[model samples]
Target: MDRRSRPKRHEESRENSRRNPTTRTIRREAIRLEDVWVAYAGSGKPAIREINLFFPLGKLVLITGPNGAGKTTLLETCLGLLKPYRGKAFLLGVDTKSRKILEARRKCSYVPQDFMKPPYESYTARQAIELGLVLENTPDKNTRVEWAAKLLGIEDLLDRPLGTLSGGQQQRVYLARALARKPLVMLLDEPFSSLDRETRKTVAEILRNYVDRENTTVIIVSHDTAPIIELADTTIWMNEGKVVKVEAK
Candidate 1:
């Protein structure tokens, strides 16, 4: 409170900001839904109704509920894949209903629940991961792909045909593909469904590290939240097409 120390305090504050710029900038929500309602084609009722949610950047969010809880619908709506029939949805501040939503979606990575390949399918795991690097002529594409594969403990499987691998191996390859992209936001559905308990914990930690180092947002939809509940910054519980509870750590 000393007037004589005011200039010193200002100098210290500026130094702190210089050390960590994120502290000086206001954190913003990466996804927001306001009174949203979404339904599939030919469906008279909305799968997710009267939903309102917001998630900030650089956070890991978990969405969990029972089988018919509409978790997947809400996740898709966040990415603008499912248009809300009754209200507004936004991704990174862009209106979901706008044509520009396509551009917004390019900044996100999505992994759906069903990623199994047919037994005869032949795409190598490496090739699948490379596809995620949509940007052509990227000098570091190989490095990124390799790093992601190794990080997921699938480097040896990279050369194997995706369909020849086991279900858990295929899942790791898909996750590697997503991680290699390093998108601003990640929308993952049941990401750990195929992994064993040990693998699930490892993958969750890897994702947490990614969120911390890259300062990106990850939203996961899962029926089993045990693996990620401890790492989540926020958890949303849904039931009967509605968000019943939200817990923030």
Candidate 2:
């Protein structure tokens, strides 16, 4: 493979780099799944159990499991939407369970598993994506929105109401919003579950380019593996609420 064309699985593991990076000095741990288990408060069993996973910044990791394996719960925990009953979930090196952790979440973005544009979020695709920048008061809001729209190949739908878009189109717009922050980390759940293989591949290639160059960490949850099997740097297999297998690609 052409060195420049390949993605860096780990910064230190690189054959060469523009600058040397160290484990201790990473900007922040994008994600850490340390003995983490999440259960709805009062529930007996955790949705996922003992997930000891570490994802470095700038790489893409894929999560695979059958339905009810707790894939959505894992993504929710990473986004701080769910608190683990046992173990810890960290975002950008800070424990996300803290009340003050909203700041930590600001550096993260998510395209939820449900993939629906919420009620008030029925804005046009561009409007929804722009809201991400508006909430952050980003300096170049228009430029950022345009970039995300173009990157996702949804520039044509920029003015279309999200409700009118097809499932695939809506998914792309959801991705636009999640990526609007140029976030340090992104959590996407079943992003391609509905798309055909060719379209899925195209989207995957676009995301791969973004993460590889911008050093963004992307953790995607999906039961489908045919498209992303080769692109992921790490793959975690969930079974009955536990990570039964982990393979480094």
Candidate 3:
């Protein structure tokens, strides 16, 4: 084309660009770790080494392994609760090492491996659940809390002191607390540890439905995977602080 024609073409291209703006690639993963390694204070060796993971959005992922497999460490590292000494970790596209990690974490929920309350703890189940909304400004906070409790069959225990409940009941309360937030991501450690077979099945169903309904990314660390395996979209196996296998449905 002639130089005059080229300028006209360029102008047309710029106009088209302005009309459509810019199109960027959609992020597929909510959590990603690139060759991550973590070590606790005074530890002889790293808890997790050379860990690489990618958890796609709206997927139910299960991390399963025997005790001492660094499952808990992996979960904490993903949330920036434990920073990686080497490599990188990202949550919802924000680097875990960045100062903005906390801001990214606000959109997520975590249920630790130990949720049992001390006997002196006086918070009721409903109060414990409501605490999940403290950082949020939801107009329907009470409705969300009640709905989560009812889903876990813990509405009756709403007024009961958390410390006074049975282990399984407390576990349900904690689960309800995390669910009530409607977080974009959920990291649950040993979610079925204290539940019976029936309760496990029920909780699994509830989680599956929640993920489907909310399009939330859920990463569950469980030594006992039978209850959640069927519903999980991906399963990651770890041993000796390394991912040994990965299975996806």
- Which ranges in model 2 have alpha carbons more than 4 Å from their true place? 1-26, 117-122
Worst 10 residues of 3 by lDDT: 19-28
lDDT (tens digit, per residue) of candidate 3 on 123-208: 99999999889988779999999998999999999999988999999999999999988888999999999999999999998888
Root-mean-square deviation (CA) per prediction: 6.0, 7.8, 6.3
Question: Per-residue alpha-carbon lDDT of model 1 for 26-67, expressed as tens digits?
Answer: 237689899999988997888999998888889999999999
Candidate 3 residue 172 C-alpha distance from true site, Å: 0.5
Sequence-dependent TM-score of model 2 = 0.85
Runs in model 3 lying further than 4 Å from the true structure: 1-26
State the lDDT at 244 in candidate 3. 97
* Model 1 global lDDT (CA atoms, 0 to 1): 0.90
Best by TM-score: 3
